[model samples]
Target: MAAVTRGSFSVLRQLLSQQYRRRCFRLQNFRSDRTLQPLIFRCDRNLQMFGSRALHTAIVSQGPIVQFKLSDIGEGIMEVTVKEWYVKEGDKVSQFDSICEVQSDKASVTITSRYDGVIKKLYYDVDATALVGKPLVDIETESSSEVIQEEDVVETPAMAREEHTHQEIKGHKTQATPAVRRLAMENNIKLSEVVGTGKDGRILKEDILNYLARQTGAILPPTPFQEIQTPGPAPAPAAAAAATARPVSTPATKPPPTTPKPVFIGKDITEPLKGFSKAMVKTMTAALKIPHFGYCDEVDLSRLVAVRAELRSVAEARGVKLSYMPFFIKAASLGLLQFPILNASVDEGCQNITYKASHNIGLAMDTSQGLLVPNVKNVQLLSVMEIAQELNRLQALGAAGQLGTGELSGGTFTLSNIGSIGGTYTKPVILPPEVAIGALGKIQILPRFDANDQVVRAHIMNVSWSADHRIIDGATMCRFSNLWKEYLENPASMMLDLK
Candidate 1:
């Protein structure tokens, strides 16, 4: 009798289950059943009422927020500091409008807006460091409803966490700050290849620096890590009370070494380095690592001086300011034709040398900002007059701090006219990759013995050269210098090579 009763109850339960499933199936096809459409809508509306109205309707009519990230402004630039901003929050901006100015290790970069929008937020302040690929500002831009709906669908925290987990599982995302990623990119090191030691397996800047130090056998700052606590589920009140009673142990972290601040003896003003001055510091640090071969000599510039004076009138009529730099640069190009090795660059491994096809001679100028070496592109193809015109343009631009990255890079050789600022001889540092650099001193009127062995007044200029001793031997540098000097001494000879 008990078995019969149990079987009857099981049969009734199965029938009720079937009925519930049929009702669910009809509701799932509510669009086909017009009678249930209003009921389903009413249920949806009731559920939405429990949710925040602002969360759903707040951004429905408004435009989407766009993040303006910093891009690669120059080669090998890892980070830049915000210098100034032209727009602020709530300001309306048009496409291609000036947004802000930033200073990198290479040059000053002007950022412009890519979209027409209102500035919603600024991520960085003046003098704050901003990493490449990081957001510099937030802009509110107009968009279509379809795009807005798509954004809203994925706006939940659960959806975001799921997407992040998916990327992590697929190994498509790297856990790192933008600065760390940039450093890895600059060194050609893959972030996945290095072991991270930060929270939740994130890579820090110190990790990259330490990895590099290990590879190069360099002594770097010590790495200090704090104690990491694993998260767990909450316990009952009684268990939590017992856990709280127990003493917690924390690992000690070593403090980083600090340098002693300098004490001033008198009135001292502190100034921060930025832009060109900051770039020069980094450049000089790297340049000093290469072995330099030095060569010094004096050239009789009396003939060249007279030739320049004769050409001044012609240059002025053409609305060009002709200087000795054009003749000096043209002569160097001619010398490069005879000895191409002086115009070549060597790899860090010293296994290969690149002989450049173009003579992109760089001319160093001292402006109010700092020292700038803007080069004259394809000096080999340009005439002396053309070189002079380009030189004038670079100087003008440098003075106004408006020189572009292209104007400042790809120099095959460099020339510094220390004479303009008053110097007899200067040991110019070789701008790396480039094998040689030359410095010209002020021209002085001095007596010298000519071929007749009689003392005569002549315009003599002292020149000093520095070259990469690893690739350029002393003999090679001297030979190149002599050839360069011959053209400057006999200004008429450069005309033979001048096409």
Candidate 2:
């Protein structure tokens, strides 16, 4: 009887295994069409499916939150060490709230949250290196009907555990663009509950402006200016009304003039060098190491000025304004074509002078942060309008302190426009790895003798060239300067093959 029972159990298990195999075989057959497709396509689809699952799992487990990995911070910043945490775990953070501080070799920046949620977890400790694009924290969202906490509450580490709880929160939120995220971080603006009015519920620039306007009391009218409108004394409360009552017969008397006293103060004050200030220091230091030779020349800009005015009108018609820098750039390019040696740089270690084929002009822009010289890549090939556009973009980026690392590098020549700063003439320092720098001073109408020996008041501008003495000789520098002046003064000569 025992042998019969064991045999019956074994037969039942075998029949169940057969049915399971049949079902698996049918499933495999149904998926055979997908398997027969290109292996690359199949792999890509599989990856997409896996990514979707991972994203879903992360969102569900972590709550309605997205972690901007360090990779999203910027290009080439693969990893960064955490300097500090502005917002602690479990802290209720709005979108664009500075959550943490990070340090890279290039710069120190604050990392902000991308969504409105409670910070549930911090993956990195202080000074821990977190790679770009790696999850740094988890955030749990709050419900719509839940009363928002008014008081600022500090978050604790214990809240990390609650991140795993599978609870759904009501209310949908908009995601911010990378540009908007940067703007908010720089401006200290809170994006959550800001009411986005963009398409698909996106936050536009106007929304940020509106938020700022509201914060600054834009709805209120401006206070009227009055010569004697100073703040009055505070009103006494009802309890002290009898005691505060004073005689109204006498006219209001002015307080006795106080003697001025000098306050001597001593304290340790440290000014942090950042942005363009830091960049300027680095550039100047590098330039000091190079052996420099200075060259100066005055260019007759009468023709150039007229041409610029004509071009300005044309540009206005085309909806593109032109600046004097483009004319200088073109003239410098022409001069470089004639005298390539001026554009060459000597490598002391390599014991060779390298001449660059491409003419990349670096424009010196004075920003509020500091002096910045961002380069225009391949300026020789671009038209005058293109050069103007590029210059405008570089100036805009420099002013905003948003210039990329590579945009600051790889320059064949540098142009400093001191003319904008009310200088008639000035010498500019040569940026290293580049042989020469050209300075454009203020243009003015001056009396001068022409080639025909008649005195005339002509629009003139001074061009000062600073070159590396080791690479460029005085004669070659003078030739380059003269060629540049000739191109500018003639204006039409730039369009011809003067080389």
Candidate 3:
């Protein structure tokens, strides 16, 4: 009787399997028809189905949130600092709108929005470091098809402040750029108390400065002069305001008897170096490892000065401001032709030396940002006039802080004119990858004995050199220096090597 009962259960299971197979075959046939497509739809309450098949539905509908990551800005930069943000959380932005600016080791670059959306979150604040390929901001895109439910989206600190920021915007809260806010923070001034004269009631840097001037009763020049008709102690506030009112000058008086003010112990403020300054720190550290051969000498520049003066008018007519830099650079390139080792770089193992074919001579510029050495490409092939033109172009870009990485790298040699800023001599440190660096001192008119032993005034300039001792000996460095000096002393000699 037990065997018969087991056989009956087995037969029932077999029949059920056959029935399920038949149903699946029918579904497959239904799917094959082009007109009859698989349909996903809500069934009765608490159920969803695709055709006749039940599906586990856990779909959460929300607008597409894009995490905008910091991208590589070229020149092998791995990271950047968040310099400024043009938009904050909850602000609406269009595609291609400049949302933020970042400072890399090379230069400052403004990043644009890739989507038309509302700024949902900012992952970084001003002056914060951001790595390439990491999210910088989150944006809720407008073009997303999915309908976003408020409860479905996660609320973050940045998003929580969005409503508050919106309310502030409606109430005409103080609007200022990041730069203006930084200035206020440095001076310990409150932007709320300072009146804004900028468009749409925005606080500017000038406003902060003016406010400080008024409080201190110091007449700051360039403060907008306004006539205050009301005169009294009551109207003093207006008169002291640097923006709206002119500062009132009072007669000087002796200080009252009181305890002497404590000697100022300078406050220590720490800040991470960014952009070119940061690059300099790393480059210089590596440069110190190279054993340097130092050399210094003087060259008579009387003929060079006269030659420059003669060409100045011609250069001005061509819209180029000619300077001693072009001649110095040109002469260096000419000297390199004779002494190629000066333009060569040694390998890390110090087993091989590379003599570069092109004389890409770098010029050290002292900019407001930091020391920048931008090279003129193929100086060996460029004429003095051409070099001068390139020099002007580079100087302009450097001054405006818009120089590119290509303009700053790939140098076979470097030249620094410390004389322009009032230096007699400087032992310039060599920039690696290529070996030698030269520094020129200020031109001085000193009396020197001529061939006839009579003292005469002559234009003299001092030059200091630093070379890789592993590759360049003192004798070779001196010989190279002499050749360069000879070219400068006789300005006409450089013309022979001009392309």
Candidate 4:
């Protein structure tokens, strides 16, 4: 028989007699299962243990703390910079709810929670690089079912006693999300000493903001945390890191370290690279991949200007605004139809030229969030008025930093209106995959010789073209520019090429 040590809780045991058959025993107070407590029993052989205790105490928790790893959001994106956090620590979240927003080199993406649970912890702060496959946040979710293998169910008497022993479990550690911790770290606040008002005394982001408001002499009087707001030794490690980085050594000997200069000697304020600026760096680098050369010339836009003035009233009657850009876009599209090679791309191997069928002209719009070139697709099919309307839409989206999906691509050619912002001319860089890009300068009145012989003040605009030497030669680029100039000089020809 097994050693049946009496427990405080009644035991419903099952036993077998050698002479007879199996029998079952029942006791009072053993009606339902105890949720908070784990079932305990003495180790026995020749018999099995089974009961209503559906969960193991060792693994059973309020919920399982799962480390949410950052998966491949893009094509082999090695890391992503955290933009904003939607959920904080201790906040209950549901499956498919957005947890945070991250920006990669190509685009911005929102991260969603995979499990329904309360946020346990966040590993990285905003603007910090979160590496692929690394934990982004921890979610404590209730696990409905768990599997316990045969080998996993058994344990030694010593092990069973250690886990089953009654003891007080204290959660004195500061419970806060990564964003809250970042705020505290940035403000030099001590999280450990600040009292939390969250579940199980969890420190929330709101608590930190409240603490800051108090420090600024707000209506909320100083709380207990105010007493512990003195500068602590947390910054000592950073100071040590700075000291370690100063010394330099040579193959023979190293120079003795000296007192370092203050970092704030000249600088007043600084900020990290955000998405807008970061995108510029990445795109500009991509733009420089091909060997680019430029062509500069002035075009006679007098005829086109007259045409625009004639149509300006008509555009106004239709509640639409017309500008010189529409004329430029029209002339460029028609010129591209003549010189299709200018609207072509070099294959990946640089062996073949892929001429695009549609003339999607990218108009570079200067925005607060860097240069955005949202193209007007199928420009060859749209009239001058329609081109103006498309430009209006694209410019609006660029200004709002709301360029829609695929609006920035499918561009067979790009035109940068640098002259609109008061530049004589600029050697604009060619956007990737496009063979050539054009620069439109501010229109100015310049003295030029007329058909007879006398110099006359003419409406002239400087045009510069940057072409990829890989495919487009200087001769082809000059010919393309002259064709564009012809359309502008003879505005009637641009209309003739319509449709």
Tell me the tens digit of each residue's lDDT in model 3 across 147-174: 2343123123323322211111111224
Q: Give stretches of model 3 more than 4 Å off.
A: 1-63, 142-266
**The candidate that achieves the highest TM-score relative to the unseen native structure:** 1
TM-score of 1: 0.64
Ranking by lDDT: 1, 3, 4, 2
lDDT, model 2, position 71 = 34
Model 2 misplaced regions, further than 4 Å: 1-69, 72-117, 120-266, 271-275, 346-350
**At residue 483, what lDDT does model 4 achieve?**
87
TM-score of each: 0.64, 0.56, 0.63, 0.57
List the global CA lDDT of all models.
0.74, 0.65, 0.73, 0.68
Model 1: runs farther than 4 Å from truth?
A: 1-61, 143-275, 449-456
Cα error, candidate 1, residue 342 (Å): 0.9
lDDT of 3: 0.73
Query: 1-499, model 1: which lDDT tens digit per residue?
Result: 9999999999999999999999999877775778866776777666678566766777665677877666644366768878889899999986546688877766666665656678999999899989876778887877554544543444333343222211121111236666777788899875533545676445678888876764453423222222112122469999999988988543345584488899878987897886677888978998998898788999998888788778877766665667788888998998899889999998878789999999999988886567888798788877887777667667756756766565778899999998877888888998978889999988788889999999988888899999998888998888888988989998877777787
Clashing pairs in 2: 69-133, 70-132, 70-133, 71-132, 71-133
Error of 4 at 473 (Å): 2.1
